[model samples]
Target: MDISGAGALVTGAASGIGAAVARRLAAEGAHVVVADMQEEKGRELAAEIGGVFVRVDVTETDQIGEAVAEATRTAPLRAVVNSAGIGGAQRTIGRDGTLGSAHDLAAFSRIIAINLIGTFDVVRQAATAMSTNEPDANGQRGAIVNMASVAAFDGQIGQAAYSASKGGVVGMTLPVARDLSASGIRLNTVAPGLIDTPIYGEGREAEEFKAQLGSHVLFPKRLGLPEELASVVLEFLRNDYLNAETVRVDGGIRMPPR
Candidate 1:
């Protein structure tokens, strides 16, 4: 589980929590691969960390394979963080409660494809690469950290698609870890709450909106920081004893259904 001089692949590394995790891994001496769809930002961050960037759309198997391959080229792939996901909010039925007003099928499908299926595909590919590595003294080849959300548990109104996708991640953690146990590849999940990220808009209006959202937190009365979430990811990667667990990084807040 030692990360130094190893290779780490983090999806959605262009921004938000994924970006923070990528930087942290690099700082820990891992050869980080910034896998994201945003070329400009991904390349910028990769350069910043002296790492490599691979434009990856997790839903595409070919792109995911390329990312895994890229990581192996750097070093023995030992760490992977699946932080690629999208958010969608729409009521199952519109205000009028009419048939045509049902949630958009395409939108729902897209969220699931990216958040759930995409995460699984990347993990599978990464595990395959890690399986080839010689185990360390602890008999550990690698570890994976998957990004889930508090929505997977306390989903609010209009969060059907997002919740379902994250729920799928939480549900699969134990089984996936068990499957990877023989290969010495451990898997865990982090279910984060409201973290200050680009998902919130910019400028004064956005700041004001974010403040209101932060007020709901149980303590410190503010949104979580991306670095705080990244720290937990590092623990998951470095702590060989951790596996098949979903830890929530929320500031003691159980979301209220709106």
Candidate 2:
């Protein structure tokens, strides 16, 4: 996709990875929509990126529809980055000491709703707009990037809901790619390990965590920088052939059992 003058929608754009992706897309000359529930932050982020801000609660399909429609109406929709998600430490057993997600259905349902379902909502809508576009000379259309996590593969103790949400994202890559093939749109996922993002904290002591993560990687032992993730993201856009695979931006972090 030619990012220049193209439009993009990024969920969870108020902070962290989503914010980074949004800023980067704007820098690349894409008209970006900062979709987030936090209106104040969303507005500020939009100002910073010189993009539009759409107040959205990704868990609701109606809000997703409104955001996408509004963004598409303004600019040429070419890319979508699904980055809205939550993380927490909750065991399969609820605080009530019950077993299975069935025992804590509400909690599990919320996680899946905001993460997996929300991601799909944006992707579906973005792809719809992308397909409507007249393809480029090579029949290329658009790109959708789904944010997953290493937890999808090596979830530790008490990571049940968050892990399951991300696992679904990882699981959907191939099917989504196949479904979008006819439209000439590409789909891929990015499973980031630990990163130096606000989801942790701005600049706390990361040495111990870096050391722990280094043991799992073949390269430098460190939490990935947001730029690292952005690099891969831009690379995916540049290489139209890349699709249906989840790129691990982690520095070999297999995650230790907690």
Candidate 3:
């Protein structure tokens, strides 16, 4: 789909991969809506990109709906990138060996709610808006790119909840694409490995952690940049035939059990 002069919404757009994507889309001439919980940073980014900023909590359906509505108010919504998610680290069987110390059900549920269910919610609402738009030359109305993780395939130790949530994203990609095919909306996923983002900390501590993770990568012995992931997302958006696929943006790394 030609996103130029159209509207696009990106969740978690305040920082990291989401920020990179919002910037890229704006550069490509799309009117970006930076939907994120960080009001300060989101507004700053929106101002920088000449886009709109919407405070959004992905887990809240009404908030997502509002964001989508705002995105479509100016131009026909053409793209959505669901990059809002949280990481969790807890073994199913805790090292404490206490029955009450197992992975907290609430925590697991929260991760799934935000990562999996939240992604679906945004896609559904965004697709609803896109459906009203006149189809492009390819009969395409919009494109959706979801954020998954390498953990979904090769989850390391203590990544039960994270893996499960991301796995659900990978599992649903094709089905969602099929469901939206009739509307000329395409859906795909990008699974990143050990990316160097704020989520992993900063300074010397983060460098050391990245070094450790980078050692596992097959080549380019370094952490993947957020921009690298954003590049892949752009490909998925521009390539109309690249639907119902999950592309791994890891640096050829198959994470080993921690």
Tell me, by TM-score, which candidate is best. Answer: 1
Tell me, by lDDT, which candidate is best: 1
List TM-score per model, in order.
0.99, 0.91, 0.98
Candidate 1 ranges beyond 4 A from true positions: none
lDDT of 3: 0.93
Cα lDDT tens digits, model 1, 204-223, are: 99999999999999987899
lDDT tens string, model 2, 24-44?
Answer: 998999989999998998999
Error of 1 at 198 (Å): 0.9
User: What is the lDDT, from 0 to 100, of the residue 90 in candidate 3?
Assistant: 84
Q: Which of 1 and 3 is ahead in lDDT?
A: 1
Which digits, one per residue and each the tens of the lDDT, describe model 3 over residues 69-132?
Answer: 9999889999899999999898898777897989899999999999999999999999989888
lDDT comparison, 2 vs 3, better candidate: 3
Q: How far is candidate 1 from the true structure (C-alpha RMSD, Å)?
A: 0.7
What's every prediction's RMSD, in angstroms? 0.7, 2.6, 0.9
| Candidate structures ordered by lDDT, highest first | 1, 3, 2
Ordering by TM-score: 1, 3, 2
